[model samples]
Target chain A: MSRIPNAFAKGTAFIGFVTGGDPSPAQSEAYILSMIKAGADLIEIGIPFSDPIAEGPVIQEANLRALAAGTTVDTLFALVRSLRRTTDVPLVFLSYLNPVLHYGYERFFATCQEAGIDGIIIPDLPFDEKDELQAIAAAHDVDLISLIAPTSANRIANIARDATGFIYLVSSLGVTGVRSEITTDLESIVRVIRSATDVPVAVGFGIHSPEQAHAVAKLADGVIVGSAIVKQIAADPAGASNKLYEYVREMKAALGA
Target chain B: MMADKKRGRFGDFGGQYIPETLMNELLDLEVSYNHYRQDAAFNAELKELLDNYAGRPSLLYYAARMTADLGGAKVYLKREDLNHTGSHKINNVLGQTLLAKKRGKTRVIAETGAGQHGVAAATAAALLGMECEVFMGKEDTERQVLNVYRMELLGARVNAVTSGTQTLKDAVNEAMREWVSRVDDTHYVLGSVMGPHPFPTMVRDFQAVISAEAREQLLEREGTLPAAVIACVGGGSNAIGMFYNFIGDKNVRLVGCEAAGRGINTSQHAATIAKGELGVFHGMKSYFCQDEYGQIAPVYSLSAGLDYPGIGPEHAYLHQTGRAEYYPVTDDEAVAGFEYLAQTEGIIAAIESAHAIAYAQKLVPTLSAKQCVVICLSGRGDKDVAAIARYRGRNVHE
Candidate 1:
């Protein structure tokens, strides 16, 4: 009965992320469509926040650019509404909690429902504080996604049991950025999560390069690539759509391989 | 006397709304704080530092000349300005730095808006033999250069943050970002009673000594409770500290003066409780200066110390429950208060504290001669002299 489609139903899913208005809304919309065409199973749109504490410099700069270009939550919703008309890609909003709180939780979730947002990932909203927005997200059939970090330790099982949609397993111990190596004992964390829940888990954060994506996909249901995709837009916004599409295709192919 | 249901949360505010990566660190911090705060040895060492080093039991001076000049109520000034670093900031930095040492962290990091907290943190770190680094907004470092030099002189490495608005909020953002990676060896000495839990409560407990001393000093001198207790609110550290002991006293009015910048009607103000909407930012669910898009608005004030986008969560709770009254003090009113008190009492108060003095000037006219008022002079104005001179269309060499 839910409009939200499963992103991992076919194969090792490819989840691609882009800030809603990194260069401009139209360009971002074009980029998203291109990524979808290039085999992105799920699309995560970042709603730029003034203070994104969980993000590293790359994403932080992207957020600043998006905000500079006049990106608002309403405009992001409008973008989502437009995307829903042509594609059935599972779309999620990667945002901090303040914007949603300011938008009014009830209205925010209701708008997400109308605009066809499949899930919401607020990195700052830990499991203990999930109740603040969980009921509203559920009432609108929006998945309030949970994150299980390498540092979760005893809290991993607790977070896993209540997770909806897919769990976002953070690959490293720090903020979202590309890393040469992920030293966290992710296999142990994934084991703890698997023992507790039946929901699918997707590994994210510090994942860049198709080889890295291939390696992460081997461990989980899907691989989430964010900063890598966003960094392309940052490098050349004029040629971002084509470049990002190529990058997404490569990552998606690697996931399947 | 309503108790917080969770470890955090003052009413519907305050929580660990941080990234999952910081969860274990915060949990570890909470455990260490809970354990050490109750330990007698920890309390005794902290008490010794407060008394012998930072100059605790700060003077409760009777402002007789100002009281006579105002011609309404007897007035007293809780001289937190007389502390070693010339502000109530030493009260909190000393406590946090000591705790950091106990946690075996060798380095301490902090963010500063006005640079007073930075100076205090640097002072504490130097005394405790810990490495100190302070992140200050580039704009703030420019405005408060003397304090920047003072911090460097005290052996602190100051990083000027050039990100978003280049102000206090940005400084805090950079500090928190740096903390996420280096939390292993560094303890973030958050300057205010804001941020996530334990911080709001921890800072308040450390600052409560102000009101505790003021209450005793006032009772001894005046033989009765003052009609009101007043302090300026940025993130509401000194205000919360000055107000903590008096919360149960139903008749003692607890007043907080917020920076109105140019005016409350203008978009440039930092009067969060006066003009902001309830939302979550900087880890706490409190009133913040934000737009319809939920982007934090650029907040301004002549006093760098008072130029913050949000108040502490406890201030939000107190404002919501009507436990205290908050008023907006315009830039002009605060500057006038600064000059007025300087001329009348020969005391140059920090412009942040001048907001409280300005509020007292208004309230004093309405009270009887027998009534008394007490204001927390949260810091000295030496660091602000150049800024004040610039405001008056004058230039200073030193």
Candidate 2:
């Protein structure tokens, strides 16, 4: 073990998203910067593709807008190059493995590391099929974060024991979307995951507001607010710098940061 | 390639269009298949099961009275209908079941059309104490009664798929979606030589034993291979098997007949070979009858077993290659053939097999008088009587 200390230090961290080249390449960098100022400890920049199987309608629609705006590998790398100027918030590229594989895994890890990316989250690449890819990620010092679900127990342990950074615990069985309330069953899922490894367990998939984040943060080491943050960005797609900062500040306060 | 050999084609069909996730897996499978194809270890395993369990090497009977009446050429029936489960479906099922057990899959998932494949898979799952879940079209669950009972008796939970057209297509969609989620502990025990990549190759290899055994039996009895071989095509397993060994022999003509519920001119038919277009459904790219938008059109067939929207990708590739000639047998002709075999030969043939019998009738007349033709009477008709009787406008009560 590299003795990587406890992740993000309890309630002080929040992860946000910026679709690569959203609206245009310039606007995407602006949105990511605004999110960082609003107290986000990490950033997940999505590389839009034609097919995204694990995504729900919201992200899928957002991706379509980004694709229409002429997002490509060159544009994405340029945007990431721009984001590294101000924030040292551990940035990560989140996507299905296909895009990463297409970008070439070793090259992707190297480029992202060069641009100061922390890790990656690929929803579909299970741990069982990740040895060679994991080795490549390790050689580049990029942690490929593993996702766990409610039904995943024994397998979650396998994932948790092997995964670095933090364990992404999806709060529900369904795809990512806005939900009304967190269920009690999530406690058991968190319990199972916490038992597996000492890595911080971050709960996501439905935390829309600071209240929701605070409730989940009581059990999980971190809370992920995706759809809610994305929804704020959608309201002012061209520019929402103030709204972005305001939303993150509320989430940080709710988490008692 | 020898006589009757498709030279890697099925009659004139079978090709591979797949993703990178499966390429290595398929190559591994092909390596195993090639290494074991002629190996005594593989044959001994297949042979032992066929003899001790499935009661295979089933009889080759001469339907003398029917042959004399139809005239033109002598006819022989390879009795696959006499296999353990009253059908040839068990042969492939047992083989794959053993393969799954060996592969260490804790559970098995399958998609079924007429439910014969479901019953066969469930039987294997029950016998081996492995978990099994079968996806059946909601429409088929209502249509195939005895098969539903048969599968339940074997302890398989049936998922009635409601997506798409709510038939075999939907069942296949649901099963594949489930397989995508549970590929770790589960083996998708494909029913036929259809679906995406490895399945087409794997199912064909397992079922090829049918024609392999039939070839030896034919040689021992007639001193040579039969002049022609015929079988029905659904996902085309029976058709593929009865024709596989003959691929090496050039003189023997192998024919696979598909169902045309009405005339090929009518939309109410499963003549995928004749009328369907190019599209991917249930995995591999095959001939499918579709509308302008590319969604699969509703397929129709008098036989539940034959009512599929797309031909197996291999069969489509074969049709394109011209290694096997594709013919469509109409519902009227198939029904008449079913009764003709039942009343004449005293063996009830499945509605699916009726298509082959219908083709054999037409083929016998076209061939020279002394030519010998073998029709693979693929399944027994006990399960199909109600559907056939209803099609004939008769009440089961009477």
Candidate 3:
């Protein structure tokens, strides 16, 4: 079945996200392996899109860099295949719907299965629009991860109930970026999600520091970091492995795992 | 209009493909819009504003000189250029701003391309006493500098977006980001019929006044329906408005002219229908000019208004069902139409609208003189004088 469940079977999961083929496909594979080696429970590889509407400037720049380096869907799938050869860490893809749609739903998920991808996180495909790919994703044993945002007040229970893989709880309002402080009441949101389903809830968006990761891990089953880690890669694409390993290790440790 | 096969869907297109952070707000906006659209007082207030402030019942003037010059179909120009904000944008802006006010939203934000929609949104916000901010592409700000000053003078903060392509699509991306940050007290006054549902539907209903008036006016003047109705399609608000009332008329052809910057064969055109694939983007499933990987391609057009990568989802649905026909008009042809209309009718239409005029030059000649075609002059050309001069090798600067 899906490797996603085993990720949260332990204590709080530590999810590290990096844009696939950022800088280059080889460099991205190195960085992902680094995170996995540093005790990342799962890895989220962003299939770089031309216009990543859900991202802030940091990830947007990374996507552009990845695309500039000739990153494509096929290349990213190859990267996943390479990653699967080295490690069995549960892997997921964070992408917008367009690239996946362009790849053809059947072919994309089938390839994902072959490449050992566990789940997917599509920022644009909310619960209402999930019907387009939900069944196809399930047939491939791919967990179509659901997201619960700060504004998902009444929708929390409904979305959480039907959610698979895990529930991605957005730590704050707005696009994916680094925030100085996340003031949203996540504990309440997680409580509602917990009452609705047994699926793990991983808080993401704006979680940069270990303290923030530790704080989030208290209320949720996992802590997900993206733009902050992407910033590390953007700073030094070649030398980001050591930095990512340390950061992921620190964040994982902060999760009290 | 054909009924949506599903809620907020037009055939297989137009769904709320957005983040969960914006879902509740969109649902609330839909509820508020649904309520206000039926409320008598809301309609009367919007009507009063459209009539008195924005200038409704825009003239359907017979272009006799051009009609005789062309020696084909009779021509009528829907004078949306004569509106208060000098385009059809004010029609939707006024309606949305009023609805935002009713929803207790004190601030309004919008994305602009040619700055017509930005200026219109600013004017509506000023009239309704709401805070206004407009995001425009950095390139557009340079191209349409005069409209930039116009919006600033009208008390709106204009942000020159420096993101991807630095054009209309980037402006929209920036605006959506701003809205996601603050959806509580603020409302995103989407400028076109492109964005998520309620926007395409609401903007069309607001702009339907164009055809509602033109249909009756045409009947009163010509004693029968025109053979075709034409308008430029950027995000296709004006075209949809012009075609909405006449959609049931099987004989009346609904024509849309898309901007082909250099040519459709080149990579520089913004002809989404002519050279695009189906993809989900900017909060809707629509036809977008994209690469094989579904990455939105950077589109080009002389008219900043039409320099968008995608069309409104409804237009996609319309194109799919063979209900409307869209043709790509090159910038050179549009410029020719721009000059021709100025000289013949003493009316300088917006370059975006000139695309429709350029297409009419080809289409009208194919029809008999007994037939007629009405073109929606979506905006004034005053803002384009400097650009047109520059395009013609003159060193004119605004």
What would the per-residue lDDT of candidate 2 be over residues A43-64, giving only the tens digit for each residue?
7788775444445557756776
TM-scores of the models, in the order given:
0.97, 0.64, 0.99
lDDT of 1 at B8: 83
lDDT of 2 at A126: 49
Q: Quick one: ranking by lDDT, best first? A: 3, 1, 2
For candidate 1, the per-residue lDDT at A74 reads: 93
Cα deviation of A143, candidate 3, in Å: 0.4
Q: Which model scores highest in TM-score?
A: 3
Give the per-residue lDDT of model 3 (tens digit) for A1-257.
89998889888999988898889999999998999999999999999998888889999999999999999999999998888888988999999999999989999999999989999999999888898999999999999999999999999999999999999999888989999999999989988999999999999999999999888888888989999999999888778999999998888888884
Q: Which stretches of candidate 3 lie over 4 Å from their true place?
A: B1-5
lDDT of 3: 0.93
Candidate 2 on B1-398: residue-level lDDT in tens?
A: 11222323343233333322222334444555566556787678777988877787888888888788887777889898888777778887777776666666778888888888898889878877899899998989988867888888888899887655677766775676565445556777888888655577778877787888888887887777888899998788888888888877888887899988888898888888888776544545567776443435678888777788777766776667666778999999999999999889898998899899988888887766577788998888888888778877887721
